[model samples]
Target: MIILGLIAGALTTGCWLPQLFKSWRTRSTKDFSWLYLAVFGTGILLWMIYGAIKGDLAITVTNSLTLTLTLAVVGLKFWLDVLKPRVRARAEPPAGGPSQRSVLPVDARAVADGTGDPARAEM
Candidate 1:
């Protein structure tokens, strides 16, 4: 049972790295939803609390690690999307307006248009 528990924890926690790396490489959070992160982080906190009450080592350990990673992602999102822009603007309000974001979001409409589907056809 302990081995099974460890495997379960490993699978869940292991998935966090790729996500973290992707975000780090991109350096933009335009594709991530603030609301989703908030709700997910809150759920992880609740899971930790529940694990403590139940004396479940697996839950406690897994959620503790997950919470740490989750919070890091949230913090990164806040730093990149909110705080950094304001600091940049104040520090060097460009002669023109603020420069464009480092990354532009993928537009669904453009993808659909390219697909040549009748639904995407212009009226």
Candidate 2:
């Protein structure tokens, strides 16, 4: 029974390792949903609290570890999703001429009249 509990705890905790590793390596959470992770982390915390209240060591340990892992991933996701973009947007551009892709002001009147320069009209 003790061995089984240990194995179960290990397996449950191990489930989060791949996600943590992926998030760490990519350092981008564009594909991850913040709300989903937030909900999952909350659920794990609740489970941990319930396990503690029930006095089940395996449950407590597994849920506690899972909660911690979830929190770590969620925290990273939040930073990558919310903070990194803002930081990157504010970062200084390299010492070169502005890229051709830079935004150009459009002539709304020309667009409305449908007789803007051929290049600008296409855009």
**Predicted structure with the largest lDDT when compared to the true one:** 1
Q: How do the residues 3-121 of candidate 2 rate in per-residue lDDT, one tens digit apiece?
A: 79868888979989998998799896667687787788788888778878988788788988888888888788878888888898778566675655555656667867877873654
What candidate 1 gets wrong by more than 4 Å, as runs, is: 94-123
Q: How accurate is candidate 1 locally (lDDT)?
A: 0.81
Off by over 4 Å in 2: 93-123
TM-score, each model? 0.72, 0.68
What RMSD does each model have against the real structure?
A: 15.3, 9.8
The local lDDT score (0 to 100) that residue 65 gets in candidate 2 is 89
Which 10 residues in a row give candidate 2 its minimum summed lDDT?
97-106
Residue-level lDDT of model 1, residues 16-117, one tens digit each, is 878988988999867779898889889989998998899888888998999999888888899999999999978874676554652344455756667654
By TM-score, the best candidate is 1
Q: What would the C-alpha RMSD of candidate 1 be, to one decimal place? A: 15.3
The clash number for model 1 is: 0
Per-candidate clashes, comma-separated: 0, 0
